[model samples]
Target: MAETKTPTPMFPVVQGGGSLIVAWQIKGKKVVVVGGGEVAAGRILNVLNADALVTVVCPALGLNPEVAYRVAQGQVTHVPRNFEPSDLDGADMVLVAVDDPAASSIIWNLCKERHIPANIADVPPECDFYFGSVHRDGPLQIMVSTNGKGPRLASTIRKFIAKQLPKDAGRAIESIGRLRIKLRQMAPDVEDGPKRMKWMIDVSDAYSWDDIGGLTDDDMDNLLKYYLSGDVPSLNVLKGLPDGKDASDIDLFDGSFGFSVGA
Candidate 1:
């Protein structure tokens, strides 16, 4: 038999490298951007969207239309100068979008000393975090990242996934959230409260968007009753139950419970 050669791995293993994805609340926080170029403009837009106070430092604002419009609208403060160490003062986050490697490196070092998070455009090794492709549908947000290995690929994947999500997915989430709060309030003292809560969450997760989006007041009441008593009630019966009545006194059916308006 001929000796077989082992194939080499296509990608090199990066030691101590993995991204911890998190949604940072930057509202009312200070964000400093060093560079007035197109890259810097994009970063500014994202920061502004998060309701953060942005201060842009550059000799002159670049030809980015959004940046210019925001500056005109007084939404962003333009320092009209080159990057300086003092610019990072009181900054919750810093973004370096300048073309000069030396200036970006200096800013990155200053951010490290100040213990502030920083991102250097096109320089993954120097960046504290990468800006991933994000998709937002009302309150629901999905972010896709390639760990700085492939940004374009991540964007493409994000677009594909965005199209797959239902238009009313966010509404369904809100309805389930309301139901969960109600369940917790009603069954706070139950011995199997945690298990019951988990069951409710699983059922909510399995519900079709149309089913959740179209839920009525009676539907919510009956759904909660079904989970608690192992009996689904007809709409008329659900309406008949007195408000604030003890759930234990409800007449529960002995057989399987069906979640339907007519059940």
Candidate 2:
């Protein structure tokens, strides 16, 4: 018998230098936006979707149609004047999109003094953080960032990634989340935490997106049985489950960019 040796791994060193990506919860938090141009409109919509309480400050004449519409509809509180230093009071975050460099600089400084995270649009040096191009589907979100280097390239990369993902990818994730919840419930003991995690890792390696997509309540019940048995279901068993929406049935790129996804 011949003994086998493990092959050396390629590109082993991990690369560094990038913003710490995280899903910041801003729901019901106050976000002050200074500007009313197209850029400001984009920022407003992004924060609004995150359920942030937004206040838009800029001259009424500065607003473009989109921002004007949002203000008219009362989607956000509109302070129809130049930004005031008092606007930073109780602000959880700030987004500055004003074209006036001097005014933007003032707001950035104020945010710095107050230790509020700020993004001075199109000005990397002044920004506490930069927004990434994002692709969203239901509860799933993928972001591509260039660290304020090339936004257009980030957007293009985002589009390419979106094109490659399954149309029902978000649904698959939701289903997996439900399974995770059930797994936790089944093994709620703190001592079983490691076992539960190991089982999940095994299941992840055993199943494909298509297999997971077709998972029904009955299938999940059957799958969970393996956790106690220390085994995983055979591929034939998973394949026998009912089919989900075919990936080829929908065109993911048809209207992908119809709306902006993130800030």
The prediction achieving the highest TM-score against the true structure is: 2
Give model 1 RMSD, 1 decimal.
6.2
Question: In each prediction, how many residue pairs overlap at the backbone (N, C-alpha, C within less than 3 A)?
Answer: 0, 0
State each model's C-alpha RMSD to the native. Answer: 6.2, 12.5
lDDT of each: 0.79, 0.85
Across 20-88, the per-residue lDDT of candidate 1 in tens digits comes to: 899889999999988777888889988887899999887654536767777889999888877778898
- TM-score list, all predictions: 0.72, 0.78
* Highest-lDDT candidate: 2
What would the TM-score be for candidate 2 when compared with the true structure? 0.78
Which sections of candidate 1 miss by over 4 Å? Answer: 1-17, 181-196, 216-263
